[model samples]
Target: MSDLKLTRRQSLVLGAGALFALGTRGAFSQDATTLTFWSVRLNTPELQAALLPILAQFEAEHPGIKVVNEPVSGNLVYPKFLTAVQGQLMPDVAEAYSYHPLQFAALGQMAEMDDLIKSWETSGRLKDVVNEFAYKKFFWNDHYWGVPYNLDPRAIYYRKDLLEAKGIKPPTNWDEFQAAAIALNDPANGVYGLSFPAGNFHITQHFFMGFMFQAGGSILDKDGNLVFGTTARDANIRALTYLTDFATKHKVTPEGIGSWDTPDAHTFFQQGRAAFGMGTGVLIGEIQRGNPDLIDKIGILETLQGPAAKLTAGFFNPMFVWNYSPAKEAAMTFVDWFTQPGRLEPLYAANPGGLWPIFKSEFDSELTRSQPLMQEMLAKVIPYTTDFAYPGTGVPEMGVIDGEKMFAAPVNEVVIGQKTPAQAIDDAQAKMAALWEE
Candidate 1:
């Protein structure tokens, strides 16, 4: 099939027209339900090939439903989704980052899956298979709004040979982490102890949040209220101070890390310029392609422990049913079928690490157990993993804050030594409060 290309503006216009036509035509056909699926992952060749076949299989089994697959560019997905929501032209099934559906759920734009999920025969099995952390992140207002799709868990990737050669053991806590970093630093040899991104990007936000969580604090409270400036101030400051100190005080990370993005840090590790780096499993693939020799020397560890907790960041892009869609039942059917281990294993195999399973059954399957690396990675992450918004405080506006980089700017200021960690945290909290008020 030829690609269905639609610019952002054109998508909005066409979406609105489609809504009008649907309304004027009255109810959909009685015999067949045609469900439109909008997904950003389809932009990739591997994902497209893996998903298209599964969708076709779904159509074959359920002859009464037709699936219309639409691929949207990652950068344009949120904006176009907003436009569709405003125009009442939402797709029947849509893929979204965890926070995106929360935004829609707040507005009652997302369909609640609690009833459907509970009534399904596989509900008990699903609960058993899926990591509670993975599914719970989608819970809001006491209802499940999204189906867990994939997991991206962050861990520390270190040079096994370098550490062994230095007679240094892997770090488990902050002090040991710092000591190891300092010991591993060799500026004359063009090696840094650690590599991290400090730019105003998603990577920066992610790692920063992991640090904050490890420090036993979060930007928002469990009640979804802004707490960074008041209740969580000290913990937030401590986390930020520790991160900035890597460059400003410890001097173990690269000199210009305050301006580096994800690629910069990843490249530093890939080229053997850094002994330790923090990232998702995808980094393994990039290393295999760019520095194949380093593959055997790489070792993974859970994020280091802090005074209060040991935590790391995990990301999920979920599949949700839009409330405005006429084929909500059909969309749920597809989601239910898609998440089953039998159907999902192939998709996971097509893109290892990139689509880590959220289900325990899948985790225990031969497909996962066959690869010890994947198994070890999952074991290290699942227990301590959390979403970007922290665990229980994912409010609608958090999505807006993340998208606009409201949290990143202040963090960047601290990293560059333009502001103290305390000051930056206070400023970020104030800015976030304004957003919540608005």
Candidate 2:
């Protein structure tokens, strides 16, 4: 992982065509000095409500600098940022994804942050507490590409009251999970033992990758070769077979659950028809805002462990400095100021619905630990969580999505005796292999 090697398959994921579109018009001089920050978050009234306070704090710290925040909502990111860069109107600092770091870093739209990190270390202001693999996700080839300000991790949400009423315990591993799913699954009683996004990749893929690796298969090995057909593949086949089967074969979950995306699944959980849901910590807050009773009934846990290891993606609102920013140092200064514990922890803790802190110190403090729901769940999670660099770009996301669609749809086929698990995996792998090869 440290070598930061890209698999042959991963290379296609960050396709150059997308990288080519990055804005590179460098019209602003380093000292002309306007820190235009670009992020889709600050644009929304919803996000700005949360962001404006931080903006006020940032301004208070730096008097000469003026901050211009631009948020580009869904579907307009490409054109919005592209036009700014093409017109020589680039953000002095921009919010970028961990997955997209390689693309932007390669595009020269973002700077190499090695020197900045070194300075942070010398000054004792840097806290790269994430695992080495995770840290390296932003560092590719030979440079540090992004400063991680926030991170996302997947967690398992279950109804504690229901489980306790039924005399069942939360699952600690896969076998226990399947058993719980079977026990809790009593549709006539109006409770589905377990639930997942049946058809959608955005809803299910992150959770599935954690399962796939735990099941002992992976999209590619460290050397970057596609390793699709193996026992781990069969494990994945069974794993999803269980997922889709809850709806199609077992009738535990409603049929066609796969088609729903994240919001849809959240709705399902909010309505209380499902016993459990897998999502980030934010989903819990959304539920509680409307129904506080739901909070007392729910418990959080890390996604259950699989055989290979506990593989999963960490969600991050990552920050990056434009390689060509008129004020690189100033942008980094903003970044450093933003991440310092004194500044960020209070803000994060205040938004209990958003993600938890990246710093373990903040995460372990009495302030965080005393809060029960997710804080307690972090106990079950902290030991097992692994941040697989999110499957970045078309090549990886596409392949995973295709594989998920191909595999999950037919899972019902196998459970109903239409195909064996091996056969299902073979069919799915073959389809995925073809797509990956493209």
Candidate 3:
């Protein structure tokens, strides 16, 4: 997700104080059952072209239902969501961030989805076909709150051609990953082994979480208690030190990464300034557009193996309904129509590897088979993909940790030489623990 540059407090004010301004959009229908759909993907022209037709078709098929598309910026959606919920003006259906559904459900703002899932003709397939681990994250408070639609799991993307030229096999573990980075590092030529953000942004938090999981550490345990400071302290410190070393000790990643965001890091790989980087399937499409010639030369690793474990974390974009929506049934009807088999072809076709298949049936579909790059990439990374709240159910506190950019604070301090890894970890633990208590 791109940075919105809005602090959590700023978003709270927007949600609380600016709600009256939001109601003036004049998009909602008066005579028909209107379902206001909010989506982050709708911000892009390609996605808009793909969805507008389908929404139009839906309105044509359903007699009295009107569908309105409201494109929300990815980073700002959570704040807008909070305001909408507080003001009782929530969109009928929304594309929630990976952790938003859990948090909103905890606040009693999201509608339960198990009953809706049960009513589908492909209910059995829908339950069985999607990635089971990603599916279960929505099962909070003994009920499901959201439906998983898109999977954007993170993986290490490397330049296969560059590795072959240097005779370096793809790195499977952190030791090998760093060794490869050092081997490939040529700063005088403006090339680095890795491109990562260290700035206090959500992308940095995302990268940190991947390494934390890789080191067999987690913020919370299965019981949803703070474990980062207690049980996972050593692993957490090791993970932080390893990632920060890219800029500080090794000097293999770009300098001033402390000021970079997602696009900055991605541009390094897109422009061939970095030999290896970590990102989601979105990288595939962006790389295709930014540098078409480098397309086939890129390869994806399942995830780099750490000393303790080898899994990765990423977004499992889920669609959720608002409990207070008057058009709840109409909203769900649109969701059902949207998720039906072969219905998602336009999105898949518009951006081949940008959005992943949430249904197992989509795997063997001709559209998927047509794109060998997506097939090879998805096959490698999807198996190892899991949500951000590893080992623990996603609690509301986890969302705050991510939204407020807590993970990046300690990381930035370490990168800038303000504190050692242990000290930074101690500070982060105290701050997060206090938040949890609140």
Scored by TM-score, the top model is 1
- What tens-digit string does per-residue lDDT give for candidate 1 at 74-111? 78977787677655577888776667777767655678
Give the runs in model 1 whose Cα sits over 4 Å from its true position.
1-27, 120-122, 370-372, 391-393
Models 1 onward score TM values of: 0.89, 0.80, 0.88
- Give me the displacement of residue 192 in model 1, in angstroms: 0.4
lDDT of 2 by residue, 1-438 (tens): 012344444444433222223343323444444577777533556566677678778887787556667776745754565456445566777774444455545445568878766776787545545444445456555677776666566777888887898888888787787777778877786667766664535446566656766766655555334455553466677555555555655566655564666677777776776777776666756765777778788888556777656655555456777776657777888877877655565445555645555655556666565557757546766445554433321123333333234545444455345676567677767766753553
lDDT of each: 0.74, 0.60, 0.75
Candidate 2 wrongly placed segments (more than 4 Å):
1-32, 41-46, 78-89, 123-128, 223-239, 346-350, 365-367, 390-438
Model 2, residue 157: what's the lDDT? Answer: 82
Question: In order, what is each prediction's RMSD in angstroms?
Answer: 5.7, 5.5, 5.1
lDDT of 1 at 218: 83
True lDDT of residue 417, candidate 2: 56
lDDT of candidate 3 over 37-140, digit per residue (tens) = 88885567888899899889999999789888988887687668766754457788877677677766655567888876676425575564455656666777
Model 3, position 167: C-alpha lDDT score: 99
